[model samples]
Target: KSVGLNQVILRYASDKHERIYGMGEQYSSLEHKGKRIPIITAEQGIGRGKQPVTFAFNRVFMGSGGNWHTTYTAIPHYVTSAARSVFLTNYSYAEFDFTDDETISILSTTPTNTLCGQIIGARSIPETVAAYTEYSGRMEPLPEWAYANGVILGMTGGSAKVRKVASMLRDAGVPLAGLWLQDWGGIRNTSIGIERVWWNWELDESNYPDWHALREEAAMNGTRLLTYTNPFLMDARGPKGRLYREAKEAGYMVQTVAGGVYRLGHEPGVSFGLLDLTNPAAVRWIEDVLHDMLKNTGAVGWMADFGEYLPFDCVLHSGEAPIAVHNRYPEDWAALNRRAMIRAGLGSKNEGGNGEGMFYSRSASSQTPRHTPLMWLGDQLVSWDAHDGMKSAVLGMLQGGLSGLALSHSDIGGYTATPGRHRTRELLMRWMELSALSDVVFRTHQGNRPLHNAQPWDTPELLDHLRDFARLHRALAPYRAELMRESSLTGMPLTRPLFMHYPHDVVASRVATQFLVGRDILAAPVMDRKTSRVHVYLPPGDTWLDVWTTQQAPAQPTGPRHGHGVWLTVDAPMGWPAVFIR
Candidate 1:
């Protein structure tokens, strides 16, 4: 059941009795009485921390990580068998080899511990994967308007500044869908709970004069308001401090052995206490607070940020093993938030609520697609490199089984450090073109820094491009919603890596620079700065039709030209990414 830190392989009696589940939608089941199947394993990347779990009979593979971050673990693909059931787990860094005779072998960068997975009987491989998807919980369909383009004005000046930008974006004819207010609601220029902390949760009247009015205006314009709330609760004076104390006393918060509550790195050394999601009372308390916000302010939802930093030195109320539970914390956190939304009748029935509930979270764990509807790639710089990085980030996330990604719009006009009005315009135009195709597109700039200010008026031309892209995004709302619903139902990724459709193609496995938006469109983003051209690989079977030019490329006959194949070529700049549909 447990492997060491280095590569090790063990053979056990092929279990004919155990039932299996959780390999996502690619494999067949063991109960199919007709045929015998081969299970093969392969090693792809090492140390990037992706571990895959496979069910041999169903051909379904689930991936997990060795560390604390969630969203890294995913169900990749699957295969099927009739006589016996098999599964593979590459925990840390490892290689899995499947023999023609159905023998499973594994090689690892470090020794890994694996679970003895169960075997199940199903009619077919796809059915097996579907069963797993159902058991893990299906993905939630995002709101129709979520697909439209919007701006995430970073935590800059104050409420006045945010409202001003919103007004201008609308006036400029930008078809904005939402406004993302980051960290502004938590503390108002200070860290959470450092001084007079309890009051921090309430509106900072000085900065947010007439906050209710602002929310009303935003909603009237078809824009939803999203704010950031981190897990860190600072130990401070007044009701804020008292809330933490009560939560802790009621066993609603996580406790550290060092006798100090957990704290996230923020200005003025702001510290935060962790809520123990395992405790039902804690869940209720958190729900009540959020309910109040929604009922009073008409706020839409929260950007549930930062559950990735749980300390190994802390304790959970459920008495679960910390190391085993660390990476699972995000799942618990998301579930708690989702539960709150449901209890307040603000979310979907699947999430145990009524309305269209959405939570944009940072970290995630297994079955995240079932709970958290949207996730932005974690913070990155606002520059060309950041722009290029978004493609890779998207590939990684999709390969890891995410439904959709919200790469911060900061890269469009460049982050705070790089300064040039013209350069900002070009970058924003290029970035917007690609962002328009994503599930949740929002523009944001880094705040608290001189160079990263993302005020829309900073560059007029960039503003024009922003408006154009926002409109394009709004037009794509129908398609985006459909995709979200499909991903939720099928466990298929919105942004797919080449390997998902072309698993048998060798070239496809290595093509990380490009990915598919859905089954039809393929995007190869320009990753290099100042470079106007790059190579693109197309999977073998289908001829590709360029999305922009409607040009088609003939497929080669050397291998499969259907299902999964690979082809490669170079493309020239077109002010946007090279998109092709077949």
Candidate 2:
């Protein structure tokens, strides 16, 4: 029913006992049985919900630290325990109200009367996922370098700093494939986290004077230079605003009601300028800019950063309703980058062919998988909090698996860093273990404030811990490659829930802390601080061997596949998170 000229509500019957999952990298939990989830894309606030950090940040920092319902990749899609899958077409602001056990409602603001969606039905969970992805979009096979690269580390500041870190890590025998420098253009430290970046996309000869030289040197050592990008461009209000000026003069930026350039505020230029993707000339201009920058700078990949901040009150060149086109903005951003990849000669040759070009996205919705080469669990707090930390990364990957984002991963040590919520020595150790076991693109972030966090180069012990886990990741590259290959063909996620493989086992449905890396391997990463052991549930009908110890499963483990399997307590030390292989 229509609430007003631009508001509507749609309700559906709900299953009281069926647990809900999948809404693009949500951190609260994997099962959203009785929670309200919003499908609006924006920064995943500092500490979600009414947590300690959130409560303080909201009052002090103007509520910038988002609540539990806030997320980066907010997709209006979900799958239930009963195998019911659904996807909504709205791109703008929307909310899924599951608080009511008997009835679920979808409330959205739209200029039109109708909304589009699909209710998928299949015989089994696997088939249901396959059909859902086939209808939405299948992910492209990851580039060969993704499997071979032991880890992709984020080293920021400038060329000099990057070289120093590289020399330290290489001397310590740590493996690295790509160095993602988010401040490639320059660094701009603001009062909060989001504005700690310079917006210009081109090479800032001042910030990176010898950028190409560093790229060449890295290439000689079998490494690649990567950078970051997003749809919005910040105006420094000075010569650093060259790109913004060009975009504005060409009438390529999103405008206001009076047809003036909107500088993310009331025209005083305190924020960034939103690039108008609806304009063909603007898209072409950005494409050329991306191609020239990468081709000239020798950057192989980039973190295609944000796409979730399209405000509904803006005027676009296409004249489409801004609210209606909000949710799909991130998908558009990914597709734009994919096209840029091809233009820059970094794209793969054939359908399943391998190439060095890769871009990892944290925000996604609608048809993003077809364009997003990789998915990284978005901004997680540096602490061990379940609402938004190491544990949330696991839930994000598993949720993406069921929702068709088949190749999701996360930052090894986490990104978001506040005063009290920064990274610690033990957190880094356990995080590396979890990352190595996943065997995807193992990577790390320097947090929002690099100097405050505990880094790998902090001590020799941390370096040795990094060296060991990176080697483990590299050693398992071949197996990870096989999983990626299977994902490309069948649309099954590399990070699967236990129930996807052991449907008959009742315990598999309830195991949320652990995840399956494809069908052959299982991992139960210790997500707690100062914790070493994890109680694992070995599903029935499989010969499970502890990956660390090579110990066989208990007797009668091959019992019927229908009941709750045996709960085994295994020793998981600092360097070893529980992992089992079939």
Q: Candidate 2 — worst ten consecutive residues by lDDT sum?
A: 555-564
What's the CA error at residue 443 for candidate 2, in Å? 1.1
Model 1: per-residue Cα lDDT over 1-582, one tens digit each: 443434445444333422222222111121122222222111111112222211221232232111111222323223333213343322233233333233444343332245333444465433444555554466666655555545544444467777777777777888766666554444433432111222234444555667778778878888777655655555667655766666666767777766544554334554667777666777778767666655665556667766665556677767654554555566777776776667667776654565555667656554555577666544333344312123434443443442122122123343323112223444445566666654345555443343334445566666686776667667766666676677666755566656556544656655656777667778776655665666888788778887767877887443434354445555646355677887
Write model 2 residue lDDT over 1-582, tens digit each, in one string.
Answer: 664466678898987876677877777766687888888877788788637788887887665778777777777888776778777775767788889888889887767766678898776677778878886677777776665766777877788988998888899998878788888888866644443667788777787999989888888878888888887776767767888888888988888888878767422335678888888999888878787878887888998888877777889999998877777788888888988888777888863323668898888886798898888888888877778788877877887777668887788788888765668888988888888876478788888777888888889999899989888888887887887778777788888888787655557777778988888888898888777688998888777899778899863344234455678988888887898987
* lDDT score at residue 385, model 2, on the 0-100 scale: 71
lDDT of each: 0.51, 0.79
Error of 1 at 80 (Å): 12
My TM-score estimates for the predictions, one after another, are 0.73, 0.93
Candidate 2: lDDT of 506? 56
Give candidates' CA RMSD values in order: 9.6, 2.8
Q: What is the lDDT of residue 420 in candidate 2?
A: 59
